[model samples]
Target: MTIAGSDSGGGAGIQADLKTFSALGCYGASVITALTAQNTRTVTMIEPASPAMIAAQMAAVFDDLDIRAVKLGMLGDARAIATVAEGLRGRDLPLVLDPVMVAKSGDTLLPDDAIATLRDLLLPRATLLTPNLPEAARLLDTTPATTEAQMAEQGAALRALGPRAVLMKGGHAAGPVCTDLLVTAAGITRLTAPRLPTRNTHGTGCTLSAAIAAGLARGLDLPEAVALAHGYLQRAIAAADGLRVGSGHGPVHHFHAVWPHV
Candidate 1:
């Protein structure tokens, strides 16, 4: 299940997550914490759901569905964070937390004050914490890592903050190859892929994390899920140019594997 926000443009947030879950052969449930009037070009407005409504949505899903794993994204504020934390407390399920702080268009999705609330309430409960360079830096209150060594260090640091594991994404780093480090207490697994040049990468982060959650829901271990999700995202980015979704940074092709390229 995905507990996140709604993107009216249908490229990121809950929309991308649901698409990824379906593409990876998993049934998805959602609890929307916020809504954004957004497109590929920009986010013009954001409206957060009331805490009661958020909790009600969560209750409805957790009540009936046989949910296996959960992916979290784009939680707007402290209230929403606390609500979700309480809702999932002691559920004993695998939780994938995507620390979504910014959009592809450079818009801020999460405020600075709410970071503390999220770290306090949700970080310790997460089975896997997924964060890009900027989001990681924001969480740690440090500069973004520019080297693999630094990424490993930061990943270890984040894992120490109570998450069982951390996946430090290297997409923001400059290079021809994008490297992601899966940091666990046991060791670090380095995943590298050739960076495809494409601007249609709007929902890459959401898609990757959701795919990992789908794998986890299907009983794959953390390392296996991360590997499959990484490869899937790489292919999606490679096929992104085949789509013409918007004028700005468009979305990755979530159905790239299933849809015939025109």
Candidate 2:
């Protein structure tokens, strides 16, 4: 299940999560925290769901269905973070938290006032926390990382923030290869793939975290899940052009290997 915002463009948020789950052979469910008016080019507007409504959606899901894992993304405000955290209270399920901050087009997704609430309330509940460079930086209240070593360092720091494992994405770093560092209670594991030259990278983060959550639902370990997600994302991005979506940063081809689109 994915607890996130709705992306009208079907390129990110809950749309991306559901697509990733389907591509990986997992049944998906969702509780939308907000609604977004967006395209591949930009996120034009975001309207957050009320706290009561957010709580209701989650209740509707938790009361039924055998949900194995949940992925979170684009929580719009403090109330949303609190409501979600409260709804999931006491459930011992795998929670994959994607600290969505800004859109690929540079639009803010999370309200500035909610950052602290996310850390204090939601961070502890995540089984795995996935954050790109800037999100990790904001969570740490520091500068964005620019190197692999720095990413590893930040990954460790983020792991300390309560997630059983933290995957720090190094896509923002300069290099031929994009490395994602996963820091866990045991240690850190680096998942690397050759960076593809593509403009269609819009929903990469949401897709990866959703894939990881699906892997968890499928009984993979944290490292194993992240590795599988890394491989999947690499293929999706490499085949993104096949989707033939919007003109800028189009959606990745989620089922590039299986159930290929005609």
lDDT by residue for model 2 over 1-262, one digit each (tens)? Answer: 9999998998889999999999999999999999999998988888889999999988898899789999999999999999999999999999999999999999999877899999999898899999999999999999999987898898888878888888999988887888888888887788888988888998999999999999999999888888899989998998898888998779888889874773
Kindly list the per-residue Cα lDDT of model 1 for residues 191-220, writing each as its tens digit.
Answer: 999988898999999999999999999999
- For every candidate, C-alpha RMSD to the true structure in Å: 0.6, 1.1
TM-score against native, each model: 0.99, 0.97
Candidate 2 accuracy as lDDT: 0.91
Q: lDDT of each structure?
A: 0.95, 0.91
* Candidate 2 lDDT for residue 192: 86
Candidate 1 weakest lDDT stretch, 10 residues? 253-262
